[model samples]
Target chain A: MSETAKSSALRGAAKSARVHVMRSQLGRVRGLGAAHGGTHHWWAERLTGIALVPLSLWFIYAALHLSGEPRSYVVRWAGNPINAALLAALVLATFHHAQLGLQAVVDDYIHHKRTRLVVLLLIRGAAALLALIALFAVLKLAISG
Target chain B: MKDIRDALMVGRTSDGRLVHRPLSPHLQVYRPQITSVLSILHRATGIALSVGTLLLVWWLAAAATGDAAYAGVSAFMRSPIGVLLLLGWTASLWYHFCAGLRHLGWDAGFGLDLPQVHRSGRAVVIAAAVLTLLTWIVGLAVM
Candidate 1:
């Protein structure tokens, strides 16, 4: 209905007595079904975020140390086994957290169904692709020496 | 139209009548406050850092490629635009970090009250600023 009609028909709509909704539903259509994600998404976002707290702080400290260093210096730095492993962990956690956060934004803001789907896919796909690239790059650097 | 006939907010009543449903993004409806603003900023910075991941991968790709490629990427990093982008990313990262800790605190059932909430909001901003400046100073000033 047009907004005018909807507005005009509001005679006691707020308190308008019993509408026969299902026993466990807000409407006849029931929602998009059990979603299946549930608390998994919530828990993963937080877990990855928690992992990133240290990973990212370490990166910042390492980055400052390498700020003005040359190509060889960076190469040597990343080549270390410990640094390589931490770097890999950081890559995985960062992208995982990032895509989750991006997904939440798209879910909340993009009301259009198809557009939301496409945007969500794009962001997630980019996150995955970039993460793989970063991991492989770190691996290559580690082994290049 | 009563001003916004939001399609998603359009719902059908029991007697086949049409009515408006409620949803959010009504952020403008409320007065601006520090707590809400910081909450929003946390998400905003998160999105920013997500985009900044592109640069991180690019830098890594350059490093993996070879000496010339690494030098090229390093030159770009030392450039003005690159520095500006890095600075923006740095600020966002630290801010998001601080705000994220506050969120974790709330999740763990700490600092739920209004006074603590507002106080922590201010603390997040201050800590982020200090950390960012310290990082850049160390990045540029120290060995």
Candidate 2:
């Protein structure tokens, strides 16, 4: 065969290989069905990333001011509605983002399959628990004070 | 011959090599860049936030447990070392927050070019500093 013909054949082979890989990927997608589990976690992380830009700055200011205050004064400041709301938002966003990021780290670096799974679960569970407790405290203070 | 036990075991290949496939290379080969460093910092802040959450929980738990526990935490917060750590954590939070916004921009198909990436990276740093300083100023004013 001519060199041109051989080149054309090689191109055809490459095309076929690409198509095969695409089909295999499609098959995997079909098998997985409508179980898009990580989407909300990802969206929450991104949303927090955006929210944190302002919230984090506010948190820093709030923390610095609170640095020298007595327990009663600090509690009263946090009990204010605006401060309480912002603090609650910050805690929630921080925990959500931390969970997503830690999950990615566990997936990437942990070699022991079982341990990796456990760690991922623990990170997520801890994040949720912490957020809940913080929210409860914020609510209590916001309502009572 | 010395005996060695394989905790995760598969059979050897016919060529007498272990049948382990090489992992895709990680961040080793590429020279460190500002973007790369910022990316790592993003992860570090994430881990810090995880620990910070525990601190938040402690604070809340103290509040729940009553005045004595709350006073203990409040006293710690007043300590010089504790204040410094809080300041550092606050800075980390702001820095991470800015960098994360930059990352989100990149994810949305913006700022992918080399110049833009570096520019955004610099912006993240400068913005964080400006924010921290502003925060401290406001904090001192309130105090």
Candidate 3:
């Protein structure tokens, strides 16, 4: 078989691999497209969530002790190398989880394709910005301490 | 239900005519039950926690910025409204945590039977409440 024929055959196999039903054709229906990387998204969300289980519990315990404490106290808390490291981990996991969860919410709630796309991008940007700002704060406090 | 019913999803036919799909029953149509309530609560608290991150970041930024900046945030946090927000966040955090664990269990093919599901749902609610109350109690005593 010619190279083109072989490649076309491979392409045909890939398209057929997709789950389809009778009276269905590609792009024939709206609101039926696969998320493509859905499993990855679900798995990553769970992984980050598992990491957060310990990180968040520890944070809550530490934060309770620091309640109504001064800014210097907070600085000292974050200044501890272990605290700083764990706190950094917490921030990253938090924003990542938040972004993924919020993205799912947006995907479900926003009916308009363009609106959903724009909102998702905005969420991605906001989560990154917040996470970076937090990490920066932790770094500054750790260094100053 | 009212707002959600707006903008029924439209499908395109082979010949390019628009066809709207039938709407799924909305929130108001459901009879309230523990399982359903907890499911909605899980998502609600997750979204709430996401919003709470803004305040967390704000406090951290204020502290890093300087004493004056931190003092400003401190004042707000001590205010009645700020205190309420903090309490709400703490509760939301705990609730989301418990519900999330329950979710993980279900994903792993556990506690999925009808009775087990209901049992776990109640457990999550109670656990979240106890945790939140304990945190605030400890927080005040330590403070």
Predictions' DockQ, in order: 0.56, 0.42, 0.62
For residues B19-122, could you state the per-residue lDDT of candidate 1 as single tens digits?
88877756678999998889899999998998899889998898888889888888888899999999999999999999999999999989999999999999
The lDDT values for all models are 0.87, 0.75, 0.88
Clashes of 2: 0
lDDT of 3 by residue, A19-127 (tens): 4543345634542434424667889999999999999999998887677888888998889999999989999999999999998888777888888889999999999
lDDT (10s digit) by residue, model 2, range B29-114: 78899978888888887777678667677876676556898888877765897677667776777787788778788779899999
Interface RMSD of each: 1.3, 2.8, 1.1
The TM-score each candidate achieves on chain A is 0.75, 0.69, 0.75
Best by DockQ: 3
Judging by TM-score against the true structure, name the best candidate. Answer: 1
**How much DockQ does model 3 earn?**
0.62
As for lDDT, the candidate ahead, 1 or 3, is 3
In model 1, state the lDDT of residue A120: 85
DockQ for candidate 2, please give it: 0.42
Choose the strongest candidate by lDDT: 3
What would the per-residue lDDT of candidate 2 be over residues A50-83, giving only the tens digit for each residue? Answer: 8877887687667667765666776788778898
Model 2: docking quality category: acceptable
Selected candidate, larger lDDT, 1 vs 2: 1
How should the candidates be ordered by DockQ, best one leading?
3, 1, 2
